[model samples]
Target: MTWKLGLYALAATVAAAPALAQDAKTLAIVVKGLDNPFFEQINLGCQKWLADNPGSEYECLYTGPASSADEAGEVQIVDDLISAGVAAIAISPSNAPAMANRIRQMAPSLPIMTIDADFLEADRDLRKTYLGTDNYLMGVKMAEEAAKLKPEGGSVCLQLGNVAADNINARAQGFRDTASGEKGIERLTGQKGWTEVEGCPVFTNDQADLANQQMSDVFTANPDLDAFILIGGWAQFAPQAYAQVTDQVMDKLKSKDLIIIAGDTLPPQTQAFRDGRSHAQVGQRPFEMGLRAPDVMLQLLKGETVEDPLYTGLDVCNQDDPGFCKDN
Candidate 1:
């Protein structure tokens, strides 16, 4: 039999089904949104796993909110997935705190884990384990890369997704701590020759268009801004706008007047790096996360004590180097 993978939103996949239908056990992979290419790679990973293990009874049901900004919608989808009685669940929460609260309220009997992002440390026990990148280290790599291009620290901006996202926050903190040359500093403000410039640390809420506009606005406000660290690849997701904006700053980039170290090496983002729009990229392996999630959750279902926080490592590359995507 030929099996196909399709994007299943909550309503179409879960609500339409009878509660806990017994036809085939479901392994649900919930991401922050349906729009991001990063998440699409994850879906592809899950599909690959299914293809490899043909004739398996488990069905990989990948779903998420229509938009990355819809934090509440993601939580609702998780709740509905639970109610639909999926055999196991792997979620990447957009808003970690709210999702943790929902999990506590419902207290699902079936096993649940996190992918790409996890609940905050205070709420760590709520999930079986987390499978994703070492976000803080990912940020540290970005900082290190930026420092290489411009040894003298200068005014900068941090491009992030939702303010409440645990993964994005961790990455931001890592960048700040490493860039400031001080460990555990709460915020970067004139520390060790580095200061996150005023009107900086702009939050894009994971929208590609908004991210590009934010970059343009920040650059406009601070023409002398030395560097930018994109904790998420929002702007680069839209390659054309990214190219246009980078074209404007190409002179600075060439002169080392401005350095950009963005996250993720998806096709478009990598092409942007090749075009010299971004100086470096520190990316997470969402495909690996998706591939490992099903088997990990299955082990949890069998009452096995799996390792918590299965880190899927990083892929660092610069304009001069192609990173791990070179293999593909």
Candidate 2:
């Protein structure tokens, strides 16, 4: 071949090398569920990372179940990703224990990381690192926000979602501990600091309809209920919850007799807060979690150590200062 042609051929090969290498390696992002905008934000974060890192030699694959409670479905998706020979996996599990077990089963073969939620402390060795909010701190923030509204303290119901998940349990306990410590805020049930309302916390399984029903039942049973501390924004995300809230709690809200605080500032929740339906929301960095997970996974794959239980900070959004929630 001519000298000039040979040089051109070598340059072409060099330019194609990175693309070929990237096409071989795959990074799978498995989240809890795509139904919620939080997870959708996570997906977007992953995409943004991929776009920002132009030289990264890995193909990103994002997937999740339709519902948050589908542990088996999430497990199956991970299994599929593993079988597809993905170089690494980042997942936000529905059931932390089951996810830990699955990760252990595939250990030393694929690098697995957690996002948005984490495995139990005992199972920390299973995943490379956890990239998400500090649930306990998030709960504390929620309680602080509640105190701002009702400084004198009053009766409040706690709406929890999927008590089995690590994040859910942590936030519930954090809120309980903080609220209990507030002498002015009185818990009306015998379920200790954690489950103090309606005898026990209402678990919504991350379903909006179930959350609405539980909220309604609690409201009916305790007509004098002063506030609702939602550990998860389940009802706000569901369309059915709109009517239920309007019918059962709107009058009380308008009268300033009832206060509602929730976590996660998605479009629906932000709109509700703007409309004066909810008092405040605890904002989680789902997009940041998504953006960070892949970076951590890449580090793990390179045999570089990363911080375990990495936190993606929290923010409180209300009508006055909406923060990022205002974007919705």
State the lDDT of candidate 2 residue by residue for 1-328, as single tens digits. Answer: 1112222334443344333243657888998777766687776666666666666677666799998778789988888888878889988878888878877786545788888888889987778888888998998888788777767667788888776688988887777667667432334342222335544578888887888888888888888877788898888888556556656778898776888889987767777877777888897867677667777888898999898778888778865677655655
Any residue pairs clashing in model 1, and if so which?
none
Give TM per candidate: 0.91, 0.85
Query: What is the C-alpha local distance difference test score of candidate 1?
Result: 0.83
Instruction: Report the C-alpha displacement of residue 158, candidate 1, in angstroms.
Output: 0.3
Backbone clash total for model 2 is 0
Task: For residues 173-288, write the lDDT of model 1, one tens digit per residue.
Answer: 89989988888876788776778888778899999999999998888888998998889999999998988888878999888799999998787776777777888888778877
lDDT of candidates 1 onward, in order: 0.83, 0.75
User: Highest lDDT, which number?
Assistant: 1
